[model samples]
Target: MPDSVSPPRTIIVTGGAGFIGSALVRHLVAHTAHEVVTLDKLTYAGDERALAEVAAHPRHHFERVDICDGEALRAAFVRREPDAVFHLAAESHVDRSIEAPAEFVQTNIAGTATLLDVIREWIDGPYAAARSDFRLVHVSTDEVYGSLPLESETRFDEGTAYDPHSPYAASKAASDHLVRAWAHTYGLPAILTHSTNNYGPWQYPEKLIPVVVLRALAGESIPVYGEGANVRDWMHVDDHVRALVAVLERGRLGRTYDIGARGELTNLSVVRDICWLLNELVPAGSGGSYERLITFVDDRPGHDLRYATDPGRAERELGWRAEIPWDEGLRATVQWFVDHRAWSVERLRRR
Candidate 1:
């Protein structure tokens, strides 16, 4: 009941037009008594239509600004004076990162540094008195831990040593370090949450689950890289958004939390499941089976074999646990895409 007891004074969320970011904003506006300011540069991957539901709410405001712009970020901080910040902006595609790493470095590393510098000034200067209650939550990915061995029984915990394998993860790893340094050196109230792969509505088509679903529905070849045996721990977007709010409200500053649902599935199995669900939900396709569209392709460089998260610390310390089962959540997600085919088509066209 913290949302009822102590409403957030003002919360600023970056990358608020992206998939996970949009879901977080919708959840906050619908379920909490907090005012929200969404700052996004609306990159090609960031679609403003994802936030159509709450875009016009009185408590919700949108600002078109890039995080790397120190002046704009500083002005935003001064204008919003947010009690908490959820930093979710980053160039997050592994393949795209491999193709063009400079964008990732500039946005993920330099952009995060810019925000930290502005925050340090705000904490030491005008907002010095209100610094104690101010909290900044940096959203990161579990890919920074690299791949787990097939024989390994343990999951990636908050204490997992950094083993980033891709340009995307390396950039995020740098940002993580910057956040930690700012917290330790300047005593800024900051926390980091590294989460597992997320699957839900509003996801971009480049990701695995969405790619398969969209391709299957469109009767296009569904690409499966490297025999599709690579595994991932999936967490529904709702669960991740809940975990983020928990960290922002009750988590210890200077600490790192790993958020996940512990639902592990291989890429092939995931694609097959999505195909099965679509076959049942939408029966108009030829061959009556979506799996026929599967097409094997070369894997991306530095592709991890597996990823899983150990959320014991988050559960024990923050009293947070993922509530939805993968079966039910995945079904709901598939049905959402089926019901909103036009939206997805338009998104793909724009991309």
Candidate 2:
């Protein structure tokens, strides 16, 4: 919401074709005057359709480059001459990470190190004069804190200790440490942000909300894990993108900001709510409802019991706060899936 973002600077957004990355890209194109260069590897989860809204924008450019490629990253730096970088490229799905951890490690940890090295060279070489003004916001997750007891009311904050349980969390934690090291040792100007679960339009169908919505609409069994007791703090993708931009523009160097909307819902409750919304919006059949399709399944290995974060620092310092309430956000998200049911079904089939 700041006025200075309208000055037409080139910014690099890694993984801008993915869910959250695309959301950030759309936000930048719609709200700011900055030219966005989206660097993506076009992985299975990285769909160009997510960036459909800004695909034709003159200020938006897409590069099919993986973050793990140091040479490609260097080339991108030289080609774009970016003023800043927003690192969001990673293997994000926890379930997929459990099945294939090597991919997570390579993309999340190794790729991050490569980007840091490239940025260091940029600052020391071509961008040396503007090094003081350069910033890199490394987007991370709250899963790095591991799980909090379901009965506890406490939430993860900036000072939370790292206790990553799954491969995904561990990979992200390693990336966070590397960012901090680069900042301290090489004096790289960087900001780190940890956020809770994000749900909204254009999210891949493999995720929870989309899975539930698509399943219910298709009259298929909606799967819930482990009695659906795990809790997560949900933040709308729109709110998260706003917080990311705020951090990039106003946050202090070497600081980590936790972003969340305080929208907590258990897995079962979320599923049930979605079913209720679908039953009302799309309707299942005569004398039947979508709630009947709820099906519980075995819990995945190393599943976190609860995850939440206090966004006090982001709200206090960056002048950003989540504006969407849980019900309203959920309603909007469910409605989006319903309206785009064909896209949802196609994505689900591909997965």
Clashes of each: 0, 0
Per-prediction TM-score: 0.97, 0.97
Look at candidate 1 and tell me the lDDT of residue 330.
Answer: 96
Model 1 TM:
0.97
What candidate 1 gets wrong by more than 4 Å, as runs, is 1-4, 284-286
Scored against the true structure, residue 184 in model 1 reaches a CA lDDT of 90
**Candidate 1 CA-lDDT value:** 0.89
RMSD of each: 1.4, 1.3
Q: Looking at candidate 1, what is the lDDT of residue 226?
A: 87
Candidate 2's error at 188, in angstroms?
A: 0.8
Over 139-237, each residue of candidate 1 has an lDDT whose tens digit, in order, gives 999998989986678789987899999999999999999999999988989999999999999888778877777788778999999899988999999
Q: Candidate 2 on 202-319: residue-level lDDT in tens? A: 8988999999988787778988999999999999999999999999888999999999999889999999989888878887778488989999999998899999899999999999
Candidate with top lDDT is 2
Candidate 2 worst ten-residue window by lDDT? 1-10
